[model samples]
Target chain A: GQQVMQIPQYQHVQEGEDFTTYCNSSTTLSNIQWYKQRPGGHPVFLIQLVKSGEVKKQKRLTFQFGEAKKNSSLHITATQTTDVGTYFCKGGSEKLVFGKGTKLTVNP
Target chain B: GAGVSQSPSNKVTEKGKDVELRCDPISGHTALYWYRQSLGQGLEFLIYFQGNSAPDKSGLPSDRFSAERTGGSVSTLTIQRTQQEDSAVYLCASSRWTGEKAFFGQGTRLTVV
Candidate 1:
């Protein structure tokens, strides 16, 4: 069985602070996808990384894929109250095995 | 369709009853997936349907859970002898055969008593 584990199950930060969540897989992954779920909303795809040691950025958000393809990270710089949500990393096989997710809470 | 659609936004049933959740994926998509999310928990893979090929039921927690996709257009997830543990938000998503980003529906929230 394949498994993707995430750290910092919960994170709370004040507006203008930074937040980061890490994900690790038990086995190598062909690719990894990140998603965000708003309070009481379904998960929305944010980004996907395929190449090893790849880093992609979206404004204040930065995504990184490990060189081994077994780990990934999502970092938010200068967070805002609107950034409150759970971030998930999905991998393993092609069935979308998702990690437990890291829930982010921001206070203004 | 513009996006995935699921029926019965919420469901409440007594123990030992049966319930079925429906999912309609975006047109022209060939990959459909079902997952369960308990309170404060992550996505729990239930099954995967790819085109007309055999489905992957490896993530199903028990035999009571089953799903089917008709004409590769719509899917239904059925649960028998529902238990309290079955109370969770069941989510459905669809993607192209290339396995790109998946578009999800609002999901059906089931609460079994």
Candidate 2:
């Protein structure tokens, strides 16, 4: 069985600050996907990275996969109140398994 | 556009009761999956249905849990003799295939009291 763990279980930042969360795994991952879930809401897909050392960006968010395919990160630049949510990193095999997630809270 | 819809957004049931949750996936999508999220279990895969054939039930937690897909459309997950440990949010997602990305439904929150 494979398990993914995320660093910084919780983080709070000023509205204009930058925030990043890291995801690591003990086993090699075939692919990784990022998701954001609002309070009391379901997980929404953000991005997916399959190749080693792959990097993708969406506006203010940047996702990267480690060269070994065992780690990943999500960085949000100039965060806003709307970016407050739990971010998850999931390792995909035949099925997808999620990490505990990093809860981001932005303050004004 | 219509995404995915799940029924009875919230469910509260007593121990030993059987409950069923339904999910309606996006039209023309061939892949549907079920997962459970809880503090103790993170996000665990339950089952996945591909096309009209039988589903992959390998991820189910126990024998008490079962699911069915009809007409290659809607799906229903049934939990028999539910226990308190079964309380969690059940999420449903559908994709074009096994390797593609997926779209999720709001999920059904189940609380076994």
State each candidate's chain A TM-score.
0.96, 0.96
Which candidate achieves the best TM-score against the true structure?
1
Each model's TM-score?
0.96, 0.88
What TM value does model 2 have? 0.88
What is candidate 1's CAPRI-style docking category based on DockQ? medium
Instruction: State residue A66's C-alpha deviation in candidate 1, in Å.
Output: 1.6
TM-score of 1: 0.96
| Model 2 agreement with the true structure over B76-108: per-residue lDDT tens digits | 999999999999999999887764677889999
Which pairs clash (backbone N, Cα, C closer than 3 Å) in model 1?
Answer: none
Error of 2 at A39 (Å): 0.7
lDDT of 2 at A32: 88
Docking quality (DockQ) for each candidate: 0.71, 0.55
| Pairs of residues clashing in candidate 2 | none
